[model samples]
Target: MNWYVVYTKPKWEKKVAERLNAIGVVAYCPLITKESQWSDRKKMVQVPLFNSYVFVQIEEKERNRIFEVVGAVRYLFWLGKPALVKDSEIEAIRSWLSVPETYEVAAEQWKKGDKIVLESGPFSSQSAVIQEVKKNHYVLILESLGCVLKVNKKEI
Candidate 1:
């Protein structure tokens, strides 16, 4: 399978994807859940990892299948050719999608944190290491518990 970038009309990305999928075209729109705040309230929405474009996995020969979808203006490439997303890049994306939540970290983000478990739960006495930094929680590996724990760092 090959990955091609599709250009959607304005905010027609979701519309283009739906129409494309209905026509038997395989399109992969990486979805990331995020907290969006308006003037009155805050809500969550699953937004496209890349705005206005989606990756498609399909055979190279079936080019016409792409343009057939409504709101799909054209493939994102120079000189009227389809662009291919690297296999490694897509694999990295898949790895990210496997997680329940995601976070964007700075360059100086600490990887190894030797923090004492502060909660009054079962593993409260355990000293843990930070497994990963997620949006709402930090994944910890408790030495005494011999298990992974996801606790909200903010709440702690």
Candidate 2:
């Protein structure tokens, strides 16, 4: 059996993982606790670490069974093949999340209009243009992903 990446409907990561598990599929949906603020109050909520993605472990012949669960759109494909996640990588994530710690990130001095490539994180190796630089964060535009990212200085 191998681990496969599944793309899910927007905001369906946790639900899809639960449904897959109920159907005898080993599913993983990594989540992180974040503080959400509303006009009335603030609360801690669990949000999926990676939006719209879930991991499932199954044999090649059982791949199609994942579709039985709602919200599972399709397997993530890379290079014309289904994207596979190594078990070691999965274990690494598990171990990393288990420990709670603060990290000091050293950000390079970047100016507006400077093009840079992300070395890690979800947008690893993606080229981005620095649109705006603020005291606390940098606004980056990722052309390939067609998204604007506001990354914190501590996360850079």
Q: Pick the candidate with the highest lDDT.
A: 2
Clashing pairs in 1: none
Deviation from native of the Cα of residue 5 in model 2, angstroms: 0.5
| Model 2 quality (TM-score) | 0.66
Question: Candidate 2, which segments miss by more than 4 Å at Cα?
Answer: 103-156
Among all candidates shown, the one with the greatest TM-score: 2
**Candidate 2, 1-156: lDDT as tens digits:** 799999999999999999999999999999899999999999999999899999999999999999999999999999999999999779867865775444333456988999999865656567999999899888999998688988778753
Clashes of each: 0, 0
lDDT of 2: 0.88
- Model 1 residue 26 CA deviation (Å) reads 0.8
**lDDT (Cα, tens digit) per residue for candidate 1, span 47-75:** 88788997777788896688888777778
Which 10 consecutive positions of candidate 1 have the poorest summed lDDT?
A: 102-111
lDDT of 2 at 136: 88
